[model samples]
Target: MKSFDIVTLTVNPSVDKSTHFSGLIAEQKIRCKDPLFDAGGGGINVSKAIERLGGSSLAVFTSGGPVGEMLKELVTKEKIDYEVIETETGTRENFIAVDDNTNSQYRFGFDGDVLTDSEVEKLLETISNLKPKFLVASGSLNEGLSSDFYQKVAEIAKTSNSKLIVDTSGQALKKVLETGAYLIKPNVGELAKLVGVERLEIDEVNEAAKKIIADGRAEIVVVSLGPQGAVLVTKNEYEFVPAPNVAKKSTVGAGDSMVGGMVWALSQNRSLKEVIRWGVACGSAATMNEGTQLFKFEDANRLFEWLKNK
Candidate 1:
């Protein structure tokens, strides 16, 4: 097997089908346009985003049945290198429909099938064996899988000396913090919940992130403020970058794109400031396209240049 500098793990991968329709009505047949099929899920999408920026990473994900086959085919079409841990149940599919009348996109997501105990063990073994420079575990856990799934991954990363970057929510997110990761990107609301607060405002992001860092949960905590931008907090450094506005299309893979950019930059030994700029740049650029199409290289470069001065 070829060695990879970066590796992404997607416990639950998905086949993303997107299309446009004139309107949304109750119990009526809605005329729709031709569908676009893409490989999706957090880690896979992050790999796609890295590819868009002329970077490469190994994408490791679960596969089963026809949907899993299709997802693999789609990822192959993107020219992404991948490793699949075959399972008994089929991979999930997500539907994204655009209401042309209202210019709104409606996303319907399905829960992935449960993974057997043996399958889970195989997954852990696979990750433990591949000691990449950066290990990214993203997306939600499969049905019947414990929230500590990512926490276990964190432990494997530690043993391998791989810097783990986690992007998840709820119990899964909370569990990983207990094990300690290299970095975590939680939006304002998620951060608030992690710190046991009702809510958090812009001014409170730094202190909240610092609290997590102080607790040894993570070395770096990135608080995403959506349109307002993002803030990066480390043990002794803090950086804030305001988001650059652009014509919006879809936000399907924006967060994944951000993680992709930051990880890629880190692998290249770029400065932390540059890391956040690339993250915001790629994330903002991803909004220019529809569906799970991450971002274009040209757009990301342009945005990065603009952010360099801002």
Candidate 2:
């Protein structure tokens, strides 16, 4: 297999199905438009977002059963290269429906099949073999998968000299901090939880993230503040880029897009300032589309230009 500068890992991927409905009512059949199925999950969507920006990444994920097979087909259709690990159980599917009347989006998610111990080992082995320059481990873990899973990945990255980018929450994230990573994208709320705080004011976000940096838990911590924007903090430097306002159609793949943009930028040797802006640019651009459609390159480029001046 050819080596890629960037590689993404998704343990609990899903086939995302979305559609629009007239209204939401119980005990009555509400008609909906035809559904649209897309390959999703954190790393998969990150790969898709990278592709949208004319960058390439190899998506590594587990797949099994019929839904897993469909997920493979969807990825192929996207023209993204991928390597799959077969699992004893199938991948899961997620549903998103937009209420046309109120324009509210309701999302329903299902649990993915539990990964066996052997499957987990295979995933790590495959990732170690790849040894990409940038290793992105994103999304939630499957039931029964240990919270230390990302920690194990962190170790492999350290050995391979790969820059690890972790995007997760809770214990898994906590464990990753033990071994440390090259980068972590934690929202403000998650950042507060990491430092054992209930809430954090905007001004306090930098100090909290700096604490993590001071502890050597992460080399660079990017704190995402949703519509408010994001702040990138390192041991010596800090940069905050405000989110650009746009006509948001949906926020389906915004976070993943941000990761994709930042990783792609890093791989291209972009400065930290441009990296965060590209992240915000791609993220905000993703909201300009409806339901898991990521972002168009033109939209992202325009947004990036507009952000460069900010």
Candidate 3:
């Protein structure tokens, strides 16, 4: 059997620093108050959310330098188990700015340094050993890595008898779908790109999602529609799960939170529809918080109750 419940893989993790400003101005002194920093990157966000929901998962990735050190400190504080491959380049940092008045947020992201072949190989070797029940790989691939990076990880998960859940966009997601991933969670925009067309209505979006399911590329496909809710497409069924109406806070890490919730529900042997219910609850919960604060068990439980009534 499975040694661990979940294992998260992030190729490019970062230290996310968020601050707030009253307004925005170009070429002007825009000083904000104190900033908040947290361990980031999609997979890390997922692992953190899982921990908050009273579940534990391992976080595996590569890091180095001062920022990486900060990441390790926060991970230690969270009591997360992680296996990091040391690299020459430091971990990257992402900045987010929120305007208290308009409630609009602006984000700036830096490109993490490229990873050497040996560094990538080290991560693969680690995956070979753990063989957790669920392999959750999220976030963007760093520079100098081919689209086949996720595909290669999927192959590793397959050989290890682990279910692979991918949360990525563009070619990285497309390539993995072609390789038949166990599950894929993509937002509306990512779904449109995968369908090879743009400008889709609900029906069109449903059709596009079915194409991937029909191809047998992925057994489960989750398409998240911002306010319209989400759709889950499986081999034999396609269902739409409505979202709870909520207001306020930032939307960062919502997708990752959804993936985390889905994996947790699956570990509990919940049905696919129940998994989607928890996924929506977690996604909605994450949006109710500011900065990198993801979905906690309390919020997730509250949202689950709201989902039952709705």
Candidate 4:
């Protein structure tokens, strides 16, 4: 087994198929453009994003049946090192379509195949043994899996002294907070939910994140504010970096790209300010591409430079 500075876990990986159509009409056969296939899931996208930034990480995910095989091939094509835990059922596939006329993207996601008890154990064992500097558990839980899955990963990271960065929502996110992670990236809405609120205004973002940090739920809390940029909150600090304006294309995988950039910067021992900038830069640049293509290295670099001066 090869060693890695960072390791990403994707229990519910997917084969993402995307296409474009002129318009969406009810019960009508819509002619669409050629389909594009990409491997997608939270951790998988993060690993892909890390690679774009000239960094390497071990991608650990579950694989089963034909769709799983195709997912492996796609990850391999990206030149990412990975480890797979085989299961009994095939992986799920997601569909994304864009209406060229309205420029609206519609995404249809499917439930992942359930994992047997043994398969779950194997995944935990693999994670325990890797013991990387950082452990990132992202994406949703599959059917038949407990919502406490990420909480278990958090416990493993705690015992191994690995800094855990989690990007998930709902019960999984809430559960993981109990074990406490090093960092967590929740958008304003998700943050609001975590803190038990209907919504959070930009002004209240800092206080909300500080409450999490105060409770030791996370050492650093990053709340993504979309076009307004993002806010980084620690026990004693609060920093907000504005998003640079860019020609928009698609938003797929943008959040994962942000996590990837921030994690890679942390691995390199960059300052918190620089880490947040890298995150925003990567995320903003990802909007320049169609479908799940993520960001271009040149674009991210340019955005990062512009952010530094602003």
- For model 1, the stretches where C-alpha displacement exceeds 4 angstroms are none
The digit string of per-residue lDDT tens for model 2 on 1-310 reads 7889999999999999999999799999989999999999999999998898888999999999999999999999999999999999988999999999999999999877789889999999999999999999999999989999999999999999999999999999999999999999999889999999999999999999999999999999999999999999999999999999899889999999999999999999999999999999999999999988889889999999999978
- lDDT (C-alpha) at residue 110 in model 3: 88
How would you encode candidate 1's per-residue C-alpha lDDT over 1-310 as one tens digit per residue?
9999999999999999999999788999999999999999999999998888788999999999999999999999999999999999999999998898888989999999999999999999999999999999999898889989999999999999999999999999999999999999999999999999999988999999999999999999988999988888999999899899899889999999999999999999999999999999999999999877889999999999999977
Q: How close is candidate 2 to the true structure, as a TM-score?
A: 0.99
Alpha-carbon error at 287 in model 1, in Å? 0.8
Off by over 4 Å in 2: none
- TM-scores of the candidates are 0.99, 0.99, 0.95, 0.98
The residue pairs that clash in candidate 1, if any, are: none
For every candidate, C-alpha RMSD to the true structure in Å: 0.7, 0.7, 1.7, 0.9
How many residue pairs clash in model 1? 0
